[model samples]
Target: MTPREQIGKQAEREYILHGKRGVTPKNLAHKMGVKLSALSQLFPTREDLILEVYRINVQEMNREREEALDRALVDSGGKPLSIESIMDARILPLARRCIEPHKGVQYQVGLSRFFTESSSIKNRILHEQFADLTQRFIDEIERALPYLPREEIRRRFQMTMAAMLGVCGILDMAAYGKEPARSEQEMWKMVHDLRDFLCEGFSAPVQDRHSPSSIHLNDGGRQWQVPLKDIACINADGDYSRVYYASGGCDMVRQTMKAWESIL
Candidate 1:
């Protein structure tokens, strides 16, 4: 490798091993058997070196994730990808890569510190780098969802990201605060549930009921007929009851449980 590439790899290793606390160009130079002046001439400043290492590390992670997604596409035999497959291809590989024992914790704590540093230049560059990656992820989502309008695709993408980040933020804060190490199984389950929610939110609306049922119910002073299987549960609210159905809507009745049962 070239001297600059060598410097970057060495610096990244040192940063990963020692984290943000003990990493310095002087120490790195000493470890590399080079004078501090030579390292400074190559990297210009300590911040420059740190930024390069950080960028390279993040890029490598993204590269692996993209490869995993590509493999999934190849295995699908050219069929339109399901939303669940898309979500798994996007998230599960990264989770597996990062969830290895101490490595995961080190990466989490180290990167969090790197981005949230008060140093203006470092913070700005890290923000830009991450924002670009996030936009690329959204673009991929849009491409996968050919049935959605452009605006709808963008909206879903934003909500998907928000949900994932919000959940992750909660876990990170708890773990960093030394509450406990959250179970990876639980985290994956939460992500799977989020995937289901995103699929429901983004995909086409279900077909409206056309067939009338023998079971009749009163809603808003008008009688409506729905199948018994469509009724999920009855929610009692004070003097009234709300009947939740499986067809993505609910109906409110002006009668109590006893009254409704008598009619049945």
Candidate 2:
């Protein structure tokens, strides 16, 4: 491999073995039998090296996911893709990777950490890639559940992604012996269980039980009921809260922010 690729690979290995914080320039250079100055010559900054590793791993993971999706499409034979199939295409690759030693899942965990804690430029680049991947999943959900509203589809997509990330996090801990690792069969079972749960959620009718359809507000002697969905946002104003609706109307209710938090 080229010097840059070698450094990137060594960096990834370090990250897998010791986590992101361990993949510093000195450690990587020592691991690769090179001087720190030489390594710095290839990557001017530590962030540059981290970003290279991130790009390599993320691109490979995305390629695998796309391949799985293509296989699913081929199997469908022009039929509409079922939620199960789409989910399998989306999730199974990551699940498989979670079992592989010192790779895949670890890389994902590191990428997530880097995105949250890295510089603004790095965060922006990662966000663009993440947003693109997210949109792809959202688009697949939209296709599977055409009857669902766009907003509902996006919400379900977010929930599904959150669950997937949760799984990754758990498996990552298990890899480090911080948590128990499941057998291959058990891991596959968990994957299917998650898929089944998400499918049910996506197929179910939208019933937002958390947010009341309308809330009653007593303003002076006049009492008015407003739809919670219509409210764009709520602002705190001393003891009272100002509620702004998407329709451009505002109301000051004799409710504290704490009360609005509970009611909303």
Candidate 3:
């Protein structure tokens, strides 16, 4: 490899492995097994290396997206890709890969701070690159009931996002607060129920002229169950009832999976 090219590769390795922002030509020289004086022939400044690493990440993310598209294409046997299905099949999984749990508190601190302070960028990136990931799910709700209006779809989307954000934010707060309010199981239940409730509201079909009544159990906080009839399925006012406490619509919302296992 040319000395210039080898220096470039070394700089990327530093950034990816160590998050080193101010990588000097000397640093790259050390990393690439070359003398500092020799390395300066091609590169000298830290920003040059920083800019290169940033461009590399963008390129890698695009390439990964392309590969995901290729796999989806093969899986579908030549079927056209829709933004929604591609998200479900690829983007969500990719996001999960970004979070790793290993022997450190820094990740928790960093991720929590990002969500709290930079949520707009975070949301925009997710929305734009994920091809309306959350929106695609919301669109599913509208498709489930063809007669639903666009405004209602938008409302349900907002409610779902609010509920998701609430779950993500509150659980982290609980982790670091003065006292943990509930065990992991209980916390999961709350989030699950919150999501289920939102989805049920979105997917409400034409109410049976006589929607059969079922038992209502606060479930002793074990499993919050309100019969299928009670969720904020359709609103005359066109607002999603996820935040509306009166609907008792826990059936459609997902409760924590752990709770069900314990109950069984």
Candidate 4:
């Protein structure tokens, strides 16, 4: 590889494996079998390299999410895919996309940590990019549930996204443990259950008792109802505390509330 390309790929690996915490010039040089001076010449500043690595990873992740979203969209077959279906599709490929120990998920999680702690200028830019990323799927949600209260639909959408990122935040090697079978099974279960529950909540009528838990997506099943509290990882206060409490970066729940306030 050319020097720049080599540096770029190595930088991505380093940052994803370590995030802002992982590596220094000396470590990077040792990993890449180069002199520290040579690495410094290539990377200049650690932050600069980290930013470049983050940019590359975000683009790659977007591509993965898009591919999965497209598959779900195409499979919608003239009908709309629900919010859960979209999320299920988005994170499924991560079984492959997130293969390297705690690489991809850690990068995503730690960057979120960094982002929330960042200055307003940086956080605002991060929020804008994040909102734009979720906007297309949000539009699809709007279309699928036309009569739903628009602002509530969007707030729930934001919470659903927070749930999505929460998985990415916590899926670590240590968390996964040694039993690959158990970890994979649990992760997959998490995906399926959350999708089914949230999609129903998203597609439900505001006052309706029916929920995704009561319905089956696979063969036309009978309609049923579940409590809203049962559908979310919420607290006694009826807010999305479980997910937000675990947010490694920005406060998504509070931000969603702020977003709803702005619109209403």
Candidate 2: lDDT over CA atoms?
Answer: 0.75
The regions of model 3 sitting more than 4 angstroms off are 1-111, 115-127, 173-181, 203-264
Q: How many collisions per candidate?
A: 0, 0, 9, 1
Which pairs clash in the backbone of model 4?
Answer: 112-249
lDDT of 1 at 173: 38
Point to the candidate with the largest lDDT: 2
Candidate 4 TM-score to native = 0.58
Shift of residue 234 alpha carbon in model 1, Å: 43
- State the local distance difference test value for candidate 3: 0.49
How are the candidates ranked when ordered by TM-score, highest leading? 2, 4, 1, 3
**lDDT, each prediction:** 0.67, 0.75, 0.49, 0.58
Candidate with top TM-score is: 2
Q: Mind giving the per-residue lDDT tens digits that candidate 3 earns over 1-264?
A: 766556666776565455544367776776667887776756666655655544444345545656665676687675555434443343333232232233112333333433443355455445544454445444544554557677666665666556654454454345556776545455556555655565566566544333445433332234454554444432222221122234453222233344333432
Model 2 weakest lDDT span, ten residues long: 169-178
Candidate 2 local lDDT, 162-236, one digit each (tens): 898677556544555656766656666777888898888879998875678898786666888887788898888
Candidate 3 residue-pair clash tally: 9
Query: What is the C-alpha lDDT profile of model 1 across 1-264, one tens digit per residue?
Result: 998889898877777677654457788789899999988888877777777777766677666666765676688765555676766655554455444465665555555566455578566664856576656555656666775666666666677766654554444334466666567666666567767876777676533234334467776679877777888878777778888888878888876887656555
lDDT over C-alpha atoms for residue 94 of model 4: 49
